[model samples]
Target: MTSSLSWRLAFCFTLWLSQPLSLQAQETLADWRDVPVAQLEQGAQNGVADAQYALGLRLEKGRGLLQNFALAATWFTRAADQGHAAAQHRLGQYYFDGIGVETNAQAALNWLRKAAQAGDATYLYDLARVLETQPEGKPLAADLYQQAADLGHQEAAVSLAVLYQNGTGVAQDFARALQLYEGPAAAGQARAQNNLGLLYVRGNGVQQDYVRAAALFQAAADQGLALAMGNLATMYENGFGVPLDEALAVELHQLAARKNSAKTGNLHPGWVFDTRLAPPDSSAEALERLRQGVTRGDPLAGFLLGWHHLQKTETSQEEFRQAARLLRSSAEAGYPPAMANLGLMYFEGRALPQDYVLGYMWLVLAASAGQPEAPELAVVLSARMTQSQLVEAQELAVIKGGDQLANR
Candidate 1:
């Protein structure tokens, strides 16, 4: 039950909870590929469902028309009334996200159900997710998830495994959970790896294996899953599966905090460095502990101490210098928050020379390391930089080994 509840909560805003519309539609939707807007509009006005759906797509994306969610929803509704499956799905999504109309869970569910009537796995999975939110719908949701899973829907497989693991509307069977998780985990599903790691950590059906658990957590963490990062941080902090590394633990915790907060558009979320079961009594003691770690060359500790100094109400020039120095050191070590902070300092000429190219380079590196705000801020900063500077900054980002993140 704990695992089941945690899975749902952890994925409340993620795990494809509100699946985004696919930009590339099916070939059937491409019928009006080169049709003029007037002709397409005429077909839609003539009650052609495909034309309506196509026009809605154009309006929704503003490809060849002004972006208008309200008009898009209207066209989707017309096509959906004609029993167009894709239109039904799109209309349901619009309702689910309140893109054009007011949010209506029941309407969304109804449209999704209509879409799933054709027995499409994607539609089934989407409907099941909505059903999972309703207390009375758990049994049906489980059935739909199973159907989708059998049809090769990886996300459905992971969700179904959670049900089996927790006996939620199903018999508790760790062996079944393990069976469902193994394929998706091997195929690079971060949630599957994380859940499977939890099972391993608890010895749910197999012998306890901290090493295997840590490896799974690391795999998911590498894909920028906050829960996985937190799990791995614990293992590192306690030396459960790997050598104890306070520096790495602190860095991982900060990374996880930053990732989670980024999802909700928070620019500067606070993080604690206390990895111990019990922590120090006062902020002064915490500062002292950070200082000790910094003296021992812990980059994250240096970054945290620097960040703390910058947060002070009345910081001196010397304090700014110390902060800049510490931030640079940690940034050089590839800590993403430090890189982002140092970039901002450089851009604003705070304790550093104003260099747009260097600042942009750091921002790009931070983005590549999974800092969500870095790319958006980088775009804003680019407006102040020349084209040559932008190109140079991009080149620097690539040369400095920015990782290529996988599409979620």
Candidate 2:
């Protein structure tokens, strides 16, 4: 369980295990769905494969029956011994994850191999995921992933892209990786979005575009992907494409850390490595770098330092004025979060004179730039403004290249 591999495989393994049994046995299960439990048990005892599988499913899921994993495993084994592919798949999963039986990798492999031989794409994908955890199983796993992908399994396609991206079980092929990731990413798959962002960051298959990378990371982060949030936070900390904002960066880090802590469980047996994404650096050295960036008049540095100052509980009026100026500078350069915070400051008359029209205008701009919290705040402000003020705000927002919030 200590082999070097991406921790992501554990997720894949768990996902495959939880997928509903495929429809290959749908007609048979339908026939047995309403059968009495006693009758089903008799049929299973009478060596009926479908009855055995159906009873196993009932016992395993507690559908109108008391849950019983040991009994479910016994019935699944009986059906699997009769060459029932679904039963074999379930039995294999039980062995692999030790659901009812003691964990046995070799037995799990043998049963899964038999199920996969039935040519179901899902079975092939599950087998591929299991094989992916083994040291010497990578080449075969790659082939299985390819086969499953060809059969239109999107998960397998993403796994195949990872193999191609890392050159683990296949020749290094950035183009192929990009191709595999594109469809899923375009369809708004979070993992594909994050991985594709990494590709853009590395300039692997396309020209390096930190702006595109940051945008992609933001997209995935909006979907609550902790890894993407961490990546985006790193970009902010370093001023990669978005303006640097150390306070915002720290906030994102805390948010991501909380999510990761909540979601992480005991490591799956298949998770053989500790290759989780690393957290971003926010050390003294990074502070010096930000200072240097500010000296060079980097808008990113100004935003970071300014936001940090604004968040302090005991900031002097002079510090507030400096923060407002820096935030205004960053907002004018099209930084969304800066626009958002600056708008809040103006609306609340904190750092600058109260200006409702200007505040609403900035919020509109921020919303148009995909700042998630801006639109609602803009709406809230609109409710308190006169019609003339609302119209003036819309006009100002449009002048700043933002969509009118009137129709919102």
Question: What tens-digit string does per-residue lDDT give for candidate 2 at 302-404?
Answer: 6776766765678898988987887787778777777877877777676699888888778767766666666556544554565456556656665665332
After superposition on all C-alphas, the RMSD of every candidate to the true structure, in Å, is 15.7, 22.7
Error of 1 at 258 (Å): 1.4
**Taking the tens digit of each residue's C-alpha lDDT, what string does model 1 give over 1-408?**
012212222665342212544333365477886799899999999999989999987665444453355778899999999998888988987787676677799899999999988777878888888888877887898999999999889999999998888888888999999999999999999999999998888889878898999999999999999999988888888787788787898999899998876665344323222233243233988989988988898887888888887777888888888989988887777777788888888777778898888887787677666665665676455556654575566567666643422311
Worst 10 residues of 1 by lDDT: 1-10
Query: Candidate 2, residue 117: CA error in Å?
Result: 1.3
Clashing pairs in 2: none
Model 2 scores a TM of: 0.59
lDDT of 1 at 313: 85
Off by over 4 Å in 2: 1-12, 15-17, 25-28, 34-36, 265-408
